[model samples]
Target chain A: MLEALRKISDVVWELPVTHKAGMRVPARIYGTEKLLQEMDEAVFDQISNVATLPGLVKHAICMPDGHFGYGFPIGGVAAMDTEEGVISPGGIGFDINCGMRLLTTNLTAGEVEPYLKSLVDLLFGRVPAGVGSRGSLSLSRTEFRRVLEEGAHWCIENELGRPEDLARTEEHGRIAGADPSLVSEKAIDRGIHQVGTLGSGNHYLEIQAARPADVYDPELARAFGITLPNQVVIMFHCGSRGFGYQVASDYLKVFLKVMEASYGIKILDRELASAPFRSPEGQDYFAAMKCAMNMSFANRQVILHRIREVFADVLGRSAEDLEMHMVYDVAHNTAKLERHLVDGTPRELLVHRKGATRAFGPGAEDLPAAYRETGQPVIIGGSMETGSYLLAGVSSGDQAFFSTAHGSGRTMSRTKARRTWRGRELWREMEERGIYVRTASWAGLAEEAGAAYKDIDEVVEATEMAGISKRVVRFTPLGNIKG
Target chain B: MPYEFLEDVATADIAFEAWGSDLEEAFSAASEATLNVMVEEPGAVRPLETREIHLEAEAVDVLLLDLLQELVYYKDAEQLMLRVDDLEVTGGPPFRLDALARGEHLDPERHRPRVDVKAVTLHRFRVEKTDRGWRASVILDI
Candidate 1:
């Protein structure tokens, strides 16, 4: 049974607290009417279930890309009082800190067009990808622990990147409170050889072009070094590699037991198993989770170093001349301690963004000084065949705990996509469109075909119109490396 | 009874599903199937070492996730390819479990991963009973 949606605005709809049992707050969804109609009813049910969790503050929000996920919708956002609320693994997702990083180069598409294939090959050789892929850098147990705690800072210390790179990253590349001891030996072993690797699925490294229509503001483009039509840029998406995976696996076992004994909270979905934020188990998981976040940060930083190396080798130019500066790095799957306005009063909350992005508006104190005026750059990745987007945070995101959509959101099942599309044909099509693709598995490639997801442009438009975030620029893919 | 492998990806209706009569049997079958989803053969895994595993979950599905994660942990960290020998699950707010898993050193020819399951997800997860026996379905966070 479904309840009538209460319209908050043309783009906002609310599921009242009365819609479900044990609901501590309402559930709000931001989407256009067309997009809302496309969503399954279960997405609403999951959002309602999230609202029912104890100590939830404000509303459980779903961005325009919202779709049915584990306990919470994929594009779900929820903030809970850190002192009294709960933390669920489902809210943080499996790939901890699975995020996007944008790199801006001084070269235009015309300058790189002749050497696109060579550049793609160099990048493919440098970045190890695909399922169960291992990287060139292998760390011992001691070094692995240090990497977990220091994140990108560790890479910078090792001369993999410059000091300036840390300031442009979220949380300055290291999340505090990470305890390496909490990580299990098994987790440590799994992650030792996986740093700088791009593990399979939707993760990718891409070269893109910014067209004139894609550029929202000319001045903004000029400032960001994205001035010319068909300017070349790089955007890569990945996470803490195997390290994050192992951390989540180890902690979920602990949390499952803690939820049962401590809270007596019975959830219909096993994936929604959770614990009170104040509990010892909760603290332990948070600490270990932060370690995973840091590990991923280091992984991305190392990959960026590899990218820089490949560019220098192929272009025959100094790294400085390439101007491969990081535009921004933002996490899509994470839970962060944040302060937000709830009912016009400031409250400390543990904000969980599963398949969502933190879209902090302009003048946010947390933002780096260089980006404070432009707000957080929300990199929304689409499939390899389609285009990705860059969006700026809007003030209205404060109502949703400063959250927005992460990606295009899957509309078709992987099985269906694989059955309908052929990898070879898809690869040829992308090649015809001047997009080079390097993939490990044909079946995996078929599963990630662009047709399997909703239109990214439509999804971003809905988010912008809903006031959750505003579009900044579009980057059309020129080449992609997928695992 | 003979066992058969089922190929259900983490998706809408056709997720990773398994069936058996009792809790141990249901869990064992599900564990075997989950490993099969990652690799080609679970039966080919010889019992090289035996490990004791005790886990707790809020429900049957959570219990399944814990169970599967343990196997993944063993496979990835220890380089052991495992198959569940026994599984017993008790239900409550905090469910308890006792399990035995056995695996040999990784044999590349026998065990090649189809996909790396980053983690097990609670999204659209369900474990219930049908007229024939018990059944469970879960979406892996890949």
Candidate 2:
């Protein structure tokens, strides 16, 4: 697989269409030479498989953080012609709209350091975590229907958040066209008690600080709402929980049953089960998918409410007094309709980004007025021991349909990480380095050891070099609540 | 051990292979491995409740996938952590399986929550008859 890659540039490699049979287009990979050499061989196979799917425009692209996933490689990007393309649940992960949210604070690390432990402890107690964790708000089947339609508006109207928060969120915290009638009873049952809960297996809420030294573009940093040196901030990663999973599971079976018979499409991987974009089954999944998307937006909005309450109570100050305003919220897993130039022709494409974040450049439509001049703020989370990054989109990002790397993708498998380190010991080591940590399970923490992931600096740098996104600021961990 | 977790099969998810003297035992072992991924101690879960399961699939592999998905569904809908107490498997164009699941709602105190498995994936999912008996390989999304 490595030998088959032809270097396109310093950071781009091409897997020619002739390399695989039935490939509609070639596969392109973005990464440094060193990063490419270390990539798993399975990544090549998976990306190549994605290239064979019908209605793909241009090439199948994999970002710097790429790794082999179930059907599509993680950090992958593909744009399909909406009028003639297909929609696959495998393209968008089971965790529909699993995304990241970041907020800026007027308070400095110095002010929060005194009570960091208290803040984290309170957050752990206030926001539910781990398997089968339930939140404070319990909704009925009927109320959940409203949540699927209104998204974050439901939370704000319920007094869980401020209205301005919607402005900083993608799609304004709500994805429309959700046919609640299409959502199943099983999915609603799973969603009823799971809102506002931080689920396990890589989901986390961490308190971090940005020092002036870590700011790469000071001008862009301030534009994105980082005003002071040693400033404190909040960033959390989660998804729609079980409601989204059930939706994807339900559709996977539906597509499998009809894909070969009704659509006459054959896939290399069964997980890649898909239906034509205009097919009855496909449109039904889209409407049902919007429900899960809105549910996740509401889920994160409620979690934000819990965080604000904990900070205010712990610091003996009003949330307003602390100036905890949101920076941006970006979804890494989703399929959306967008207009992009394909071979010099403007076309509407259904972009599927799994483990990839949309990094639309400055002046792109749908961006809030405040971000029109600075492009979209992209949040890239690192492992607990390592730091996370903030980047912004550039016009050059159009090379890959305005998509960028999602995170510091894992290098070692969970089994290897568990065999190498004890979670209890890793917790002690992080504390020694000034990162206060709290988690529901120690064994689970071991699986996310910093050493288990690729170097975040290298991953972020490769994206910038590829001109997909540019770095703005780096954040160091101060405290964490691992679900 | 009837089952063992495998490395290199999946990078970001969990994968395991299980075996037994026959098809029923192979399915049972796969259930235990799946439970172990969510809880630190399987034995700690006492049989505080029982739920009946009846499913029919066109193939053996689909049968195993559907059965495992039932466990994931109950975890979210009712917060239950169920274990297969006993099961009966019959082969045909439409394979049939009936089982009694016994466990309790997830109690963080006893179950010792590890990772919440979101769903089971068809990526490399398989069931095969071996010289000794049967084996099943499964991958889970987290």
Candidate 3:
């Protein structure tokens, strides 16, 4: 009942446009044969479904880490005509603006290794995490609304972070056109007390060891003040918390009813419900979604401030000497207005990257001036046990809408994983391997055991071989705090 | 009928196994199990009135989501507590459903808050039948 896949190249495979009805474009998957075979067949079906959406340009692409997801496979990328296309919540995913951030510190791992446990404890005490977790900072309804609008800029204005930090963040730490009025009351209530909290499941704060001195670019490392083989750095992965969840929830309900009545777009799945870009409902959802994205930027900014305080207090070093500089921040789940080449002609498109990262190549005008020559930094978070990676977008990604993999995709189902491993045993094993972990639930630990995911090295290798992004540095985890 | 709860870090999946000669009974039993994930008491709410609800879905998985979201919408927006009464699923290119839901006014003390069903994820979703009756397995986006 399925068509045979056509091999486009060693690192590329194509599902011809005719494989599915109503397809506007073909589907291209970037990965090696081994990685491709490991993927679930459902991924092809999902990607093909994405291609069938109206006004889809070029191809519907799946990164090496691609896996089965709602409408767009996780790690899927697609560009649509801004004037005539549609936007689906399934394409951006439920966790709007889920992203990663990296910070460099002056202290070497040797200096902090002795007090790593204490540092992890302090961090755990400061940043609230876990399911239904609430933070110490309680915002009045008005202040909460302001945070939804101002984003990380609000954090910097409140002295939580340095103003310069915003320059290194995607979209300068805030996306424009966010309308707080579009956010529902239920969404506002859900996010009011959750600003600085880290909601459970795959969100974490980890301390990692930098790559060997010779492996990193000397000039860039020096500019970023990152040096020494055993340098201690902080990396975290989280999102807009309850705010993003509520935003997606509110819109999905609205879209479900409106899409049928307005556009006559019949989807194969309710999860893929969508509305035309020109519709009022679509514009409102985009604005509200942007507000949630800004809220996440502020959440991570506050967490970074807390990390700085803990480092200064425990190390007895001045904030200046700690030299905690934000290297980069990138979102994994989002749909943005971008310019891309469509059939050799430049056009504006709405690019949807669900569980994928925008890896714009060097000299992109949108990149910060400092990074113009090197390209945007791409942060790929591996499982806590395997550590994470820092990569730079390369020129070849220009042909693929400038996107790359977000992480090592899930390989095993959680049910099978929990049955095979015990939480306590897994915790002890990670500690024995020199990775300290602080978590609120042991059951959660078992579900996220390293064995549950694919090999990050192989996923990254596939991306690199496909000319999407190039690895700059590899980090080994020393300690982690999970929600 | 028996149901088993499966655990995931982000969401929880439960498997409902029921035996019935007809489709309506199996649908009723499965619906009961699905709501059971959110509350401890299924029979505590007095049946004040019965309302007929209809839904059309593209697949069995989406039908399940549409059914659950309808219940959630009633609970949140309309302040109604509901349990499936009579239900039927006619599967085709577009699955059609006819159902009745019974519930009373909200008694806050009787119903305790559980995990929020943020969204119905397509991750690891399955619905199949066994020798006994029918089974539907789903992962809720919590």
Q: How well is each residue in A1-483 modelled by candidate 2, as lDDT tens digits? A: 778999999999999999989899999999998888767887888899999898999999998998878778888899999977899888888999999999988989998999999999999999898887899998988899999999999999999999999999999999989888987898888888998999988899999999889999999999998989999999999999999999999999999999999889989999889999999999999999989999999999999999999999999898888888889989998999899987788889999999999999999988999999999999999998899999999999999999999998888887778889998999999999999999988878998899888889999999999999999999999999998
Candidate with maximal TM-score: 2
Give candidate 1's whole-model lDDT. Answer: 0.81
10 residues in a row with least lDDT, candidate 1 chain A: A217-226
TM-score of 1: 0.89
- Model 2 chain A TM-score equals 0.99
TM-score per candidate: 0.89, 0.99, 0.84
- Calculate each model's fnat, 2 decimals: 0.35, 0.82, 0.10
Q: Give the C-alpha interface root-mean-square deviation per candidate.
A: 3.7, 1.0, 6.0
Relative to the unseen true structure, what is the C-alpha lDDT of residue A160 in candidate 2, on a scale of 0 to 100? 94
Off by over 4 Å in 1: A1-3, A266-268, B1-14, B19-32, B39-67, B78-113, B122-136
Candidate 1 local lDDT, A1-483, one digit each (tens): 223689888788999888878778999988877778877777888888898887788788988888777778889898989887888888887788999998888888889888888888888878987645677886889998999999999999999998888988999999999999998887887888778988777788999999888998666566556777788889999998777887776777677777877778777666677888888888888999998899899989999999889888889997789999988899988999998987888888999998899999988999988878877888999988889998888788788888999998877776577678888899999899889887765667877899878889889998887788888889999988877
Order the numbered candidates by TM-score, best leading: 2, 1, 3
| Runs with alpha carbons beyond 4 Å of true place in candidate 3 | A1-3, A213-225, B5-118, B122-137
